[model samples]
Target: MLDSLLPPLNEHNLPYPDTIHPIVVHFVIAMVLFAFVCDTVSYFTRNPKLAEVSWWNLVFATVSIFIAVIFGQIEAGLAEPYDAAVSTLNLHSILGWSLSGVLAAVTGWRYVLRLQNKPQLPTPYIVASVALVGLVIAQTYLGDLLVWVYGLHSVPVVEATRGGQL
Candidate 1:
């Protein structure tokens, strides 16, 4: 019924040229990692400019993650994931949502520190940033497993599922 309301799906089962989730997600990953880099570098160099850079990166990462997760949910729904891919997809989705909240919370804390013009990052913020990077790494691994290992949304996977081969 919903199919009638939308344009035809592509080979990847999306209504557009390609999956948008990954594209947006890469930006989030880059920003998140770069933010951590800036923070760490600032920590050692005592440069306020790097802190400002990290702050902007965190702010953008917080915003872009939501967009990534939204498109991720949409694409995951249309993916027609097979049995082998289901668990990973579900985990990825759960982590994706969890990361959104985590990113927001970290950003909020960072904003508070930024407002105070704190020169050095507190130990607690460093700890939380480390944890956030760990989560992002785990999420990236799961995402890779989904596409590279389980082949979710790949042409062959889509075709096989349609033909009952998956």
Candidate 2:
């Protein structure tokens, strides 16, 4: 009997390579955390330039977070996570969407502050920024648990599932 060999593919299988979600999300995570740092530093140092930098970072991060979320949704479906990973994945997905909205709202507030030419960040905004940092940390932890601990979309996981061993 003659037959063609099956082509190799990575876990979360598709013929071509794909890593868009993690790459975009990580960039967004860095941008948001750095923005918070700049915001806090400017608040303490009274440096208008750093505040300006912080504003731009927030604006870009708000936009990028949406992109990250969209790609994450697509990849998450492709991942087809196992039973153990489902709850974590769902939580991460919810948080990812929620964070996008929260970032946009915070960015809008910051835009108002920028327009008003505020001398320093108000305490309320700073407090909210701290909360945002906490949320980001929680989201990061969930993502880490999925990839590092549960091995969602990893090669071995995919192979086992395909082999009906999972």
Candidate 1 lDDT, 8-43, residue by residue in tens? 988888889888999999999999999999999999
Over 1-166, each residue of candidate 2 has an lDDT whose tens digit, in order, gives: 2225644557666434765877888888898899999999999999999999989989888888999898888778777688889999999999999999998999999999999998899999999999998988999999899889988777887788888877
lDDT score, candidate 2, position 66: 92
lDDT of each: 0.94, 0.86
Cα RMSD of predicted structure 1 = 0.8
**Cα RMSD to the true fold for all candidates:** 0.8, 4.1
lDDT of 2: 0.86
lDDT of 1: 0.94
Error of 2 at 145 (Å): 0.8
- Each prediction's total of clashing residue pairs, residues at least 3 apart in sequence or on different chains, is 0, 0
